[model samples]
Target: MQHSIPPGGRVSGFRLAKLLGEWRRRGARHGSADLAAAVRMLVLDGRLPAGTRLPAEREMAEALPVSRTMVSAALDQLRAEGLVASRRGAGTWISLPSGGALVGGADTPLVGSSMVDFARAAPPAIPGLLPAFDAVRARLPEQLVDHGYYEHGVPELRRRIAQRFEARGLPTSPDQILVTSGAQHALALVLRMLTGPGDRVLVEQPSYPNALDAIKAMSAIPVPVAMTDTGWDLPGIAAALRQAAPRMAYVVPDFHNPTAHRMDAETRAGLADLARRARTPLVVDETIVELDLDGDPLDGPPPVASYADDLVVTLGSASKSHWAGLRIGWIRASTEVVHRLVSSRTALDLGSAVLDQMVLAELLTEPESGLADRRRHLAGQRDVLMAGLREHLPQWRFDRPGGGLSVWCELDAPVSTRIAVVAQNHGMRLAPGARFGAHGGFERWLRLPFVLPPDVLREAVRRLGLVAAAVSGGGSVPHQEVEVPVA
Candidate 1:
């Protein structure tokens, strides 16, 4: 059962004001677009959970330092898109999609509005990314005269990506690197190229949802090997490989998503050996490899590819460690695999964007210092999120993640999806745990990202607590009261 805000209640002026961060810094034309885009992004992203009351136009304008006209224009645009609805006396409220029609579509509002989103597991673009883009703009003229297609990737980018692997103790060459739009694209390409219909693929339980979707899109049977808060089950994985004999295995070794379990060196070695024996090529997603916030700063592990050079296909991306907007990712594999990916990619698209590639190349050439800065920023945010959760939602439980963007939380009731639904009414967006599992499991879990600033995160958790209370009959159920399986 979901609860609604009392009539005439308005969203806090402070929260509405925070939504205008940096919009004024851009100038009026850009400011209006930025303001509208931020609000639209919030609604679509489920942060402005359905039914959240919008601040009065005057209130918003006063708080954000924008004119009333700009605020009205933004609101009018939102109203035209059906993301907001207003009445004679009641204020405007956020609306949800109707009959699968997204926010920018149908004229009808499905539900109400929300103001905070905990669904996004991605980090904000670093303050330094803009400077990198400016540098790339200066260098753009050098490459613009030539034909702007490089399926294998720009030479400098390939070299930098390969050099990153080499720096991490896995020797590589530019010839072994094939750049793609992002890790998801790289994973999709690998799945398409390697697996045929009816082939079996091994994956971690509670794996990245998009990766699971990619496997299913290929019509490949997914054999999930269970992972825990501790790490992967080596024997179980080995048995799955032996039993299912999957053609390919996809694993996220460092700072795994959802669970945030990093594979130990021994487990990595065992999996590599198992995959090699099964002749199964492991597609390792290392997007979060450099985000090791808890480890000794100097004691970084080598790439898993270092152990099984012949069998592992390593995927690297600028998304997790760097800015995702750059949309740059690469695959480091055998030269033969690289060649095949290049040939197969034309069927998907030409190469990545030229400007993004150049920008990423500059970022990769000097990544460690930037990654360190990111680690510190994330660590602080992570603490804030953990502390907030402890204070507001004391009944829920989650192990502290050493790295990665989210905390995989365990709710007391088997109502993770229900909680998510009820949360929308309270202006919070959440990803139900079932989305992460290959099978319809994890109904008692949810992945909550600590990517937002401290104050926003505190508000999100506070809202989550309200929804959790509603779902749990005014109190959290004890773990012994329910026997849900952990992923």
Candidate 2:
């Protein structure tokens, strides 16, 4: 039997035959029920997703060495079960039924649980984490014996965080602070407090995927405002706000994830103005603000919240700057907004861990704390990864991101998904660019983290180079001769 595999899915005709043959060998009936079950398992296991078009009956029958009658019968059975749906002239599509319609049994592998996941945006832990944990242990007794776990958050920690923000030029008050487990939780609390389900929210295109997921989880509509390689498209953002009339907008102004573009001062001011004009709340994620990898870290400009007090919510997290396991994050907003957020947060974990907040407070107040060590370590790692990429896979085009954990690279071809699969086979994980975009765009790009150690990053790049060569159908070539400009 011969089958024509889809473009992105390179499962060959022979492979399909083998899969079907194995199913037959298991003594399952060769009818449509059995075939539908097999295909359902594949879809549920993430090998296929909704809207994936199956081959034509003639093509599938030829590939499976089955009669066309059998192919048609199997498809009909699948359609009846609502596991597959067909449209006239558009061909048949495999779709999971909406809500509570369980087609497969408990033994089937779940969609996200079965893949070799590289879509995570988390950075590796700082080298100081072990020592930080030790330090936390030395002071755990007092925290454990404390009676009340909720004073909003530990007082000492809140004070320290406020002081740290002040040192960075953003004046904050401890009364305006509320600690949370992570940035995601903080964002959720803010969303729940500010807007209701079905309210519209504006987000940047090719932004953080988890933000989109959170918005959708709240049943909010996410209107994506396109951004550019140079910086935020202020006019585009304004247009999106005007058209969508969103209740809020989420912006990652400093060293944005996936894109690595920083919002310039002028753009920041314009955005604040835009939000004020639109009467929409603006949430700025400053998680990657302090990770400057380029020249001298000049405190560039005031935070967006500083520009517009009533309409902006500034969020910060120690996860990116310090350790993800620490799970400490805060929001610096007006007292009114802080009170509302805290009120909404009562149902969500009753406040953050008391001991973790205390530890963060100690780290923030210490003159030569783990935060300083983290900054220095990340700078060195970024340099190491950049140098390795320069020496190895220079055909890929990427800028030296000024301050961010990852470098966004544009490949010559739209094969990021393919390259990711091949790299995983070679023991390297990769984030395909499409995962960062809505409507499955950014197919020609990749996001590579420089947060790993020098040696591990070097090895990963070597493996990535080999995978790129394989995907490109060419042998390794000499590094492209280009001047390495200081970012």
lDDT of each: 0.76, 0.69
Pairs that clash in candidate 2: 1-62, 1-63
Per-residue lDDT of model 2, residues 142-172, tens digit only: 7777674673678888788788667767788
- lDDT for 213 (candidate 1): 84
Q: For each predicted model, how many residue pairs clash, with residues at least 3 apart or on different chains? A: 13, 2
The TM-scores, one per candidate, come to 0.75, 0.70
lDDT of 2: 0.69
Best by TM-score: 1
- Quote the RMSD, in angstroms, for model 2: 18.5
